[model samples]
Target chain A: MIAELVLAMLFGLLLLGIHRKVIARIQRRPGPPVWQEILHAAKFSFKTTWVPATASGALFAGIVLVAVGIWTAAFFVMMTGGSLLIIFGIYMLHKIVEHAFGLSSGSPYGKFGGVRSVISAASEIPLFVSVAVIGLFTGSLELTEITAWEAVHGPLFFTAFPAVVAMYLVLLSKMPFGPFSIVESKELVSGYKTEHFGAWRAGLEVCNGLKTTVLLATFLLVFAGQLPVLWMVIGMILLTVSLSFACAVTPMLSPFDSVTIQSLVTALMLVYAGIVFTGVLP
Target chain B: MGSLGGIPLYVLEFGDELVYFSPYTITLFLLALTFTLLAIVSRPERQVDVAFGGDAYTTKIISVDEMRFRRFMAIACGLASMGAMVTGDVFNFTLFTAMVGITNVGIVAAVKSPHVQDAAYQYGLVALSATVPLFGAAALYAAATGSLSMIELAKGTLPAVPLVAKALLVIGVVGEGMAPFYAAKAEMFRAPGAPYVIMCSLSSLLIFLRVAEVVMIG
Candidate 1:
């Protein structure tokens, strides 16, 4: 488990660097080395990290720990091939962590970020719809069961392609620089993380990297299952690169716009899920 | 009528020695209990004396008396939510749902901002109107099945309910701020106290969860 966590964290940070490099290259600018995230972490570890005086002291500090804790648990779940429902639950709870991060800072920027986070939770509906679709297709919510089914029946994407797309969109919304990155957009002066500096910021970056890693890994295991370990890792990197390209091409949507788009997607996914649930598709 | 930690907790008086503790009720009860404890223990978002981006206002702080009252209302809301969750009878569930709405308004009514007061007023009016559908659903259920007890209905003692009653129940709960009706209560979150404001959202969520369980299981 410890090894899994360490590898996940490392890969997460590495993915983050890859994302930056991808976007930079897309703009024809020289990008930092792919290890830039590691360098940032090392630099921040040596610097002083202080709690803001204007902040809600306990909550401000606790939010980072909460983020770290939840993502760590998510990492554990992914590594152990635990129930996907548990993973989805943790993902839902991460919305609370995001809201807490913003609200605890007592800064208007943070509050805005928090509010955006709340609105973005509506995105969960579509994700839930996708989960239900996947569950219907596989006859289970357990990752092991889904993977086992995939091993015998081939990948679910071959049949439940719409659900795979829905899940992919949900993943896009979580990726850095994705259209729904309004929570930490530059317009909000880094938004929720505005007040979190130094080591706390480093902790958030690491958590973000872990979240990215877990999400990509989940996508691989859940949708593209039955691959060998070498192929699985390669598949994950390809996914990271594809997501980075998607992020680079798309501009961030306004907070309200993101919510609107998410809701529309959720409505569509719900319709698809309903059709599946009714046994109209099989 | 059951005992928890040696303290008798009244559920529904179905009859002598016929207590209801179904999995549906248990799930709602536990969810409410969890959020209630959270409302009590979670640290609130701090409202600072300073403002940024040239938007300046006097530092907003609730008086000790008002804070006490808000906390009381929040706890009351929590209790009402839990009540709505665990009730075995449809009428009692609707009654508790109405109480949850009332206490939800009361939780945020103490904030002095005109915006919050305006939002509370809007919510209060909606809550008042929502009771009609809520109680009407219960009445419809009773009239349709000759009983309002979910346990009795779940036992196949009653016929399946009219679709209208189910729809009404869901609409009534939604008007209490789930999704579409959430806009009415959005401004209420502007209230300076996080703990109290949180109850407004939490109660609605719990009630929604309970409603989903009730609709499917009952």
Candidate 2:
């Protein structure tokens, strides 16, 4: 399990590197190398670290561990094909981690970052909606059962298209440069992460990598059903690349606008869910 | 026994209520446990109000009186969340969820910041009103079917729970979670004490997750 987590962290960071690369190429700039993020994490870890005088001592430090810990458990949940509801729960909890990251340091910028994360709770609502829609179509909330249903029938990707779109928007919101990622917007000077530095930042980087892996791989596993490890990795890369292209072409929306768009997508998902509930989507 | 790992680890029955452990609920319960531990061990941070983006921090330490109150509320919130995650009866789940809501508001009540207080006040109103649907849904379930037990409801023997009752349950859970859930609720996080403040959000999200399973299973 440890080895798998380590590999997932490495691979997840590499995907992020690729995300940066894709974004840079699209903008016609020379971005850092694909291994830039790995080096970044290593570089941060070697630096001196300390809790800020004004920060909540234990929380300022402990949130990082919780940040990494939750995502690590999320990775195993996906790996073991646990209930999809557990994954949904963890995904919602990530927002709280962002809130804690921002508020723990008591930095003004961090507080606003945390506040923005809370206001953006609309983004995760569609996650549960998407989960419900999938359960509605497949008649089970178990990941294994959903995959089995897809094996018997074709992928829900064809039958329940809007759930896919909703999940994709969820991925975008969490992605680093995506329009919905107001929490880490540059104006807040790294946003929720502004107060965290050194080994703490490295811990966050590890969490981010695992998060990227679990979310993308979960999306693929759910929609595409079971696959060999290589196929799954390849699919994840493709999905990340596609997300990068979206991030590259678009400018970041204002925070309210970001929420507006996410809310709209959620509404659309609900409409789709309503249609499915009425027996119209089959 | 299966690849999809929601194996039930243990079941404890007390008189008429059952609290069981599955891989999923245990994960949530452990999270509440960890955060409660944090509340017990951590000191509240002094909030730095860089309202002008400069080095101006309020520097006023969170008071001892408030600290004890918040710690108490945080632990209560955590325990309520842990209960909401594991309860086997539908009405028991609703009661635990209501406790989570009250404790969520209580966690923020000691902030002493007018903004946080106002947000908590509004959230309390929503949470209090949410109980109508919450208990109402449970009553509906008991009326429609002869039992309020989730295990019994899941057996496909008694009359299936009405769709309206399930929808009402979801509505109630959404309101209970609305503290960290809505745009205005963000203001409550402005309260100091990240460790304790976090219990408010964590409890809401966990209960919401549990309800998703409740509606799905029962």
Q: Pick the candidate with the highest lDDT.
A: 2
Badly placed stretches (over 4 Å) of model 1 are A280-282, B1-58, B74-103, B125-173, B177-185, B199-218
RMSD (CA, angstroms), candidate 1: 5.9
Q: In order, what DockQ does each candidate have?
A: 0.18, 0.62
Put down candidate 2 lDDT per residue, B154-207, tens digits, no spaces: 777888788899999988988887787667456687677888878887888788
Q: What digit string (tens of lDDT, one per residue) describes model 1 on residues B72-146?
A: 888898899888766777788888888888888887777877887887888888888888898889899989988
In candidate 1, the second chain superimposes onto the true chain B with a TM-score of 0.82
User: Where does model 2 exceed 4 Å of error?
Assistant: A280-282, B1-5, B51-55
Q: For candidate 1, list the clashing residue pairs, or say none.
A: none
Q: How close is candidate 2 to the true structure, as a TM-score?
A: 0.96
User: How many steric clashes between backbone atoms does each model show?
Assistant: 0, 0
- Please state the error at residue B82 of candidate 1 in Å: 7.7
DockQ, 0 to 1 scale, candidate 1: 0.18
Query: Which candidate tops TM-score?
Result: 2
